[model samples]
Target: MAISDGETWVLASHNAGKIKELRDILAPRGIALKSAVELDLPEPEETEPTFEGNAALKARAACEATGLTCLADDSGLSVDALDGAPGIYSARWAGEPRDFGRAMQRVHDELGEAADRTARFVSVIALARPDGSISRYRGEVAGTIIWPPRGKGGFGYDPVFCPAGERRTFGEMAPEEKRQLSHRARALAAMIAAEFGS
Candidate 1:
């Protein structure tokens, strides 16, 4: 599962945020990343029930399309009070054109004065090879949702998610700061350790 320096891999995502974060992390290690959008690849429907399954599905699709190694991630915010209502359906909650503001409001509305505000961001990264082999890694960061959604920086539900031991939500943090604590970063770390070494 080792990757060599200077290898180009396809990122199985069209999300600008995820692509930037992954490129920032992997580029220094000498890996070049291209997004599915850049390659004009079709996005596969994520019909899997879990994060790992969905990630693998996307990665496999990209890998097969390009005959190149591919990386994909399935990530979401799960609220404890809601019993993880939007776990795998995170993106779907945002609807078309991805209106995260609406999704965040729905979370708050459903919560409706509930005492438990605990939640966690979950991510699973899947690496797929041209031959169809796949490896998956999972990461999570526990946090709580805040009302009145703070900052305008990060995409998705970052404005309301305050990680444990942090006063500010992810949206309030700089890109570099948020990257240090993001669920995606943690998952990428595990994948790098296995495929790209330290």
Candidate 2:
């Protein structure tokens, strides 16, 4: 499970935010990253129910399409009060074009009157070879949802959710700080450790 230095890795995602995050996470390790959009790869359908399933689905598609090692992640914010309403459907909550504002607003509306505001951000990452073999990693952070969005640094629901034991929302943290504790970063670190024996 060793990746050679200077190997090109395709990040199977169209989101600019995710691409930036992945590049920032892997760049320091000497991996060269190319986003799916950059490669003109079609967005794979995420029909799977679980994060791992979805991640594998995308990774497989991208690997097969480009004949390169592909990395994909499926992440979502789950609120205990909503019983994880937007677990797998987080991106689809606002329909096509993906409106995070509408999605976040809907989450707030649905959680109205619920005493519990506990929530968690979960991420599952899969690295797949063109031959179909795969490796996986997962990370999660427990937190509570703030009524009004705070800060403006992170994308998605970062402004409204604060991880447990943290005084500020992810959006309030600097990029370097957020990368240290973010679910995606945690998962990526785990994957790197497993692959490189770090």
Candidate 3:
């Protein structure tokens, strides 16, 4: 996974947002990234029950498809009061068009008047090599849900999520600011530590 040995690797995701963030993170590191959408690879069914499992499924699928080293990300928002719901189904909850606004509202409606609004964002990054070796890393951030939403930056349930001790919502923070506390960033950091090291 030290990527210092490879010229290019597949980012096993059709999500442009995810790809964009990966590109931003990887490009400066001297790694070339190709998205599954860009490669026209099929997205495997995320039937796995956990983030790590799903990430492995996607990474393996893409590696099998293109015979290249592939990396995939599976992440979600888990609401404590909601009993970890919307964790694996984070994207599905947004529906076909990916209307996060509706998803946010649904959380608001479902958790009506609850005192405990604690939540967390979780992420898992899986990398599958062509030789069938795989490595996984995880990251998370604790936060609380807010009402009426706020700002307009990050995607998903970001508008309503405020990281612990932060005055602004994830949606209100700048991309750089958000990245500092982002689950994905933490996951990537772990991946680098395990695979690339300092």
The sequence of per-residue lDDT tens digits that candidate 3 reaches over residues 26-145 is 776677999988898888899999999999999999999999888999999999999997999999988988899988988899889989999999999999999999999999999999
After superposing all C-alphas onto the true structure, candidate 1 shows an RMSD in angstroms of: 0.7
TM-score list, all predictions: 0.98, 0.97, 0.97
In model 3, the Cα lDDT at residue 164 comes to: 97
Worst 10 residues of 1 by lDDT: 189-198
On TM-score, the candidate that comes out on top is 1
lDDT of each: 0.93, 0.90, 0.90
TM-score of 2: 0.97
TM-score of 3: 0.97
RMSD of every prediction: 0.7, 0.9, 1.1
Candidate 1, which segments miss by more than 4 Å at Cα? none
Identify the leading candidate in terms of lDDT: 1
lDDT of 2 by residue, 89-111 (tens): 88888778888888889988999
